[model samples]
Target: MNISAIDLTIFVFYCLLIMFVGLFVSRTKKGTEKDSKDYFLAGRGLAWWAIGASIIASNISAEQFVGMSGSGYAIGLAMATYEWIAALGLIIVAKFFIPIFLEKKIFTMPQFLEERFDKRVKTVMAIFWLAVFIFINLTSILYLGALTIEKIMGFPMIFGIIGLAIFAGIYSIYGGLKAVALTDVIQVIFLVGGGLITTYIALNLLGEGDGAIQGFSNLYTKTQDKFHLILDKSHPGYKDLPGISVIIGGLWVANLYYWGCNQYIIQRALAAKSVEEAQKGMIFAGFIKLFIPLLVVIPGIAAFALEAPLSKSDEAYPWLLSNLLPVGVKGVAFAALTAAIVSSLASMMNSISTIFTLDIYKPYLRKKANETELVRTGRWASFVSLIIAIAIAPLLSGLDQAFQYIQEFTGFISPGALSIFLAGFFYKRATANGALLAAIGSFVFSGLLKYIQPELPWMDRMGIVFIFCCLTIVISALIEKKGVSEKSINITFDLFKTTKSFNIAACIIIIILAAFYTIWW
Candidate 1:
């Protein structure tokens, strides 16, 4: 794990470049300052490419590089269902979700709740999101990112955690989403390039230097059990994936919630210059997602094939980097890992500030806060949130599979949140009271199910909870004798339409995914 001088140089240069880009984009002309729109939504100016790159950049992090790789090591390619299914999820979000969001002109997810339901629901969900973002999302990212740094550089975990927090906060806290999104374009380049290099090297080593293709062939031949797309009951990892549930059941709830309803993720699409731009960006992300397993999962399977010595499954990616990469290439791969970590941290921080300032502070604490004051408050919010996450991040050090831990805990909120949103979008009779019940019941139902039926697969439990929440909304509305709330969104077919190119790209993605599952099934 000893770092060579050349690798250290490349990593340093990459950090400086990212910081410079972030700061440059954040710069404002004299007498002109960033308003809430500029700071929170990137001034609603992001083009399709930036939106696409930023979405994936913010999405893939140490969770995938470290945690998901760990899952790959333990469960094999079955771990890829999260990424592959997410491709279809992005398309669904693009077609069904983004249009409503853009049409409503909402800044944060909480604002959408307020417009569709009531302030009570908005406030409750906003607080819930804040807690989850800081405690679960940000903390996990920092912990896993630091874990990678510790494995690759042989540094103490605390040093890696603090260093990552500082690097992310330096530009992101000051610049906001504009800086984060713009700089993410470069981050995506490094992330993809470096990740691919690591995969290529690992595969080459597995193939005994025959090349990546032979490496992949050798990997598949030797590790055939790892290639299954669906895991049955007898498989040790079936509980984690739960065979058919991944395709037809609770995974849909997870994907839709994470991609469509999550503030940090949908914020990129919200910032797009147009709805068309947003949809196109989603389409682009879908294509990129199809290849993510190659970068993240294949390396872990390659590690299994090569017999990487590791204390835990999460060490797979780091083991590859430490053992296989040449000096110059190692620097690039490290930069890639750092890029994934910091970009996601920056995105999460920006979203945290956006939700707190716009949804909480402006509405309640400072009813008449102006643009300058709100922007300043957002910056402060970002700083505080990062500090909190950095402090608690070390607690996650004991997790065996951080990815599954994230999914299980986050599921507590996702079922409720997704139920509320889906009801609000399509069910005219959905009342604020009903939405509120679903919001609260989501956590209660999930917890009860987990406690009472500990053997139930987590995905199946989520599906059951989602159904109960949906029913709660329905029964509450029935009891209230409401037909259609005044706040119900007027649906129009035109809002879901996409460009020819977007449609074609989406079709290509679907075809490719179908071929993959067919071959692997």
Candidate 2:
């Protein structure tokens, strides 16, 4: 697949615009120990619109563009679980977790752990989060985006990668979290708008071959099995991805941990001005989540209808672009893809740098460091992490499943962090020692099962491991009941106050969209 002069020019233009935005933000964006708070957490003062769009941009990456579309090719509509499950999880986070985070004014989730539990819990989480974010999450997105260019446009892998790393690092280094957040908003508009256009074109292509009715029938045939929510042992990996278990036992725990507890992902909400604003942002992201299938998954099915069996595993999305998009629209779509890749790269790089600077550097290196010094340190950290991520990116280029690899490595924290945080907040009797132990136990259990069983239901493996970790913490805390803080018995629930009308309205909208998703066609 040759990248035409026009597509290459368009892609380059988007990258330049991203750099321009980063440079623009760096001069205006504040930074210091006083501003360090702003650099890392967007001054803790983002409006809902910015927060909402940034959430979409930061969250959707080349993984979804390439990996998710690949899943659509294999599993059909079943892959939509990653997007939809988050809807339930975000509401839970918006209602339950955001309040606690904002109420405490926690700089990071690990900070919340230290506040509620102990320093040991915080330190352990920091190490786990940093490792997963750097090696697994950041590396995979960089790899997949680079690989997409390598396969689709005939560029060397290193070119797609260094270009991404240097570009993302430059802005992220200078502009900090505010730059990352604002850039994310712009990226998401490209991501969603470009994705919808692709979806529209692919579906329109279906009408050409067999006409609309026959095309719809062919589309159903390609994806019909994916709609069934039960395990079917007959097909390959069917057992690996049974819809009901995939959603219930599997995705539920994973999404809760991701959307609810992961610091890098949830910091967009943490950056919001008020709890109400944060809730609005998460709910808005939830609404956007519902539309993702229409963009990513539906297009993959449409590809099956028109251009069947896209070769070179990752070619699913690119093949559709070659066949579906018109010339000028291809340029816009390419920009959108660039925007998604760069935005995610910037978000991950920014978060990793934040953790290193605040969690590891300042406390251990120079406790008396001022805001100005910390800001400089963060810049250095971002540069170094980008280098490491760029190096690791090529390694993931040929992986069979990007999302699965990401989830596997990410389990090091999500299950463990969720358990520790829940225990700290709800189970007052939970001991810091027990929480730390739970973190270690959860990682070992999940990792061992995933590696050994390989064939065991991934979700149940994760769910059972999560339960084991929760039980360990709960029982240990109960045994240490004598040490529990009696005054902490109350929720100190000030964090949870939100306009009743907003939540009710959000729920009503969800029901309406969900009904349409189910009943339409």
Please give the range of 10 consecutive residues that has the lowest summed lDDT in model 2.
Answer: 26-35
Alpha-carbon lDDT, every model:
0.94, 0.77
For model 1, the stretches where C-alpha displacement exceeds 4 angstroms are none
TM-scores for every candidate against the unseen true structure = 0.99, 0.93
Q: What is the overall TM-score of model 1 with all chains considered together?
A: 0.99
Model 2, span 1-521: residue lDDT tens: 56677777877787788788877876752442336887888788889988888878888888888777776776667667678777777888888888888877877887777777777888888888888888888888888888767766777989989977877887888888889988787788888998888876676566566655565566776567655434466756464464456655766777888888887788888889998999998888888988888777777667655655655445678777765677778878877777888888888877877877888888889899988888888889878877888888888856776766676566556677778777777887888878888999987898888789888766667777888899988788677775665524258556566788667856865686466446431
TM-score between candidate 2 and the true structure: 0.93
What's the CA error at residue 358 for candidate 1, in Å? Answer: 0.9
Winning candidate number (lDDT):
1
lDDT of 1 by residue, 1-521 (tens): 57899999999999999999999999999989999999999899999999999999999999999988999999999888899999999999999999999999899999999999999999999999999999999999999999989988999999999999999999999999999999999999999999999998888887786887998999999999999989999999998999999999999999999999999999999999989999999989998999999988888888888898888999999888898899899999999999999999999999999999999999999999999999999999999998899899999888889999999999999999999999989999999999999999999999999999999999999999999999999999999997989999898888778888888888898899899889987
Best by TM-score: 1
